[model samples]
Target: MVLRKLFRRQAEPDVQIEKGLEKTRKGVFLEITRLFDRSEIDDELFEDLEMLLIQADVGWDVSQRLVKELQDRIAAERIVNPADAREVLRLEMIQLLELATRNRKVKILQRGVPFVILVTGVNGTGKTTSIAKLAQYHQGFGRTVMLAAGDTFRAAAIDQLKVWGERLDCPVIAHQQGADPGAVVFDAMVAAHNRNVDVLIVDTAGRLHTKHNLMAELHKLRKIMQKHVPEAPQEVILVIDATTGQNGLVQANEFSKSVEITDIMISKLDSTARGGIAFSVAKELGTPISYIGTGERATDMAEFRPDTYVDSLFFGEGEGF
Candidate 1:
């Protein structure tokens, strides 16, 4: 919810994330701004506030934690005017987000074996687009990128990744529909090594008929990559649909159980008002959010910056919540 609602002007991209989070910002801050009207800070002040946070998609545990944090700050600071406590609240929420990322930068390809990222998500989560944006993002840094259409479950997924591969001017190693996904990744790894590609992004199946099967397949894919480069598959990036609200947390948890999720990419943020799922993701999974989809273009994605995000959300003057 915060880092620097130190209430300053934000950069252009910050403004875009702020705009995309408008729905969530309004929902969460409106009630918070209303609470500021109270002259006294008491236990009753936070009554039902947990529910409010949950309604904003902040998740249950973090909501309770934020409320308790507010209680502690009020007593420690001898705060009377509820308005002065807003900054305290902001700091605590920022701490939650920061704790999730732990000040670590998103992993880009480094000098070594081909840096591999395995992307996974349920169907309709915009996994493919997130992969494309990720490739474009690395290409912006001048890295040689390649894509592997390991998503043989759906014919469309293969064609879509191929389209992105062509558009980004990167090589795409793929097998025909119904081919073994792990074999696809294995061949992609060989190609990446031969070509000295800096990054190899592998797209996996969106959904499998059984959870157990999906889990096994992911393990196979990981092993296949490691066969080529022991330390490869450096990051397992999970793309989630922001509009899925709290349910997205369940998806993250389920997938994490299947494969280690090192980072997150939230897609279609601009389309949802309840983008507070970002807070829940950090609190529940403790994974750094790599990017947020702000629009449809390749550049529509924004690398998440906790401080800039908070400043942008709470920036304007006297704007009624």
Candidate 2:
């Protein structure tokens, strides 16, 4: 699908996000030419090109391998034109991203059991807002959905989810401040089951990915859910901020060790210049990104589609995927 269609009639274009991409693309294009424009493709040029990619946060190993592959392809084809070289480089980068963009759709909810999705991330990563948007998405599909404010550590968190519930007209299960998040989740499960809701999304507290104690708390929460429903918490989603760049990957790696992160939801994509990090996360971790939050609006969340994303990044103008 084209990028234009992906966002077609969805809403107004986000001006700030478009401006950010414009600036990022300018830098990326300059880097591409500066690194590849001079002289013939040689060993030294390849090494320099690799360095450029690494500096862009592509990671050292991947950059080296990509440069090698490009050199070999160019050498074997005996390509000489600079424009052709640029196109080839673009295609290769797109192909690398294609690996992660293969499957972008969310998994279908299981029958007879509410699809339970637990959202987690470090504080200030937009976890709460992502949950609200997700609820709106599911509600639009005509699915009966319930939200659980399992981040009982913060009273404001409960109120935040409640606001979303009220806006979407969906039921929300929450507790007082300092309440056990696990207990909240268990209550939510019972409520969802009784109401025969199609989905139950639980919002958890944002903790540092490096915080051992906080990570352990997540483990305990999962164990409690298992006690109530053995196969509960069917989907553990990690909400990542795209602007954090490589640091986002570090968070994903750490969180994956603590909980089985079945999928990812990248937020603030429109506001970040480092959108390529999405490809890096997928390529390095092998976890498919299910959705992306393009803006702050509730309807701005869209299913991740590789073709549309690649087109948007490289072609600069096209329909949505």
Question: In terms of lDDT, which candidate is strongest?
Answer: 1
Where does the lowest 10-residue lDDT sum fall in candidate 2? 11-20
Q: State the local distance difference test value for candidate 1.
A: 0.79
**What C-alpha lDDT values do all the predictions have?**
0.79, 0.73
| Residue pairs that clash (backbone atoms under 3 angstroms), model 1 | none
* Model 2 agreement with the true structure over 235-272: per-residue lDDT tens digits: 78899888787898898888888777877888887676
lDDT of 1 by residue, 1-321 (tens): 122222222235676677667765666656756766777776666876677777777788888989998988788889878777877877777777786678355455557579999998888898889888888777767688999998898899899999988777789999999999988998999999999999999998878888888889989999888888887689888898988988888988898887888888888888876666878888888778877887776667877867756654454334543
TM-score, cand. 2 vs. native? 0.82
> Candidate 1 at residue 68, lDDT?
90
Candidate 1's error at 183, in angstroms? 1.9
Best by TM-score: 1
Each candidate's clash count: 0, 10
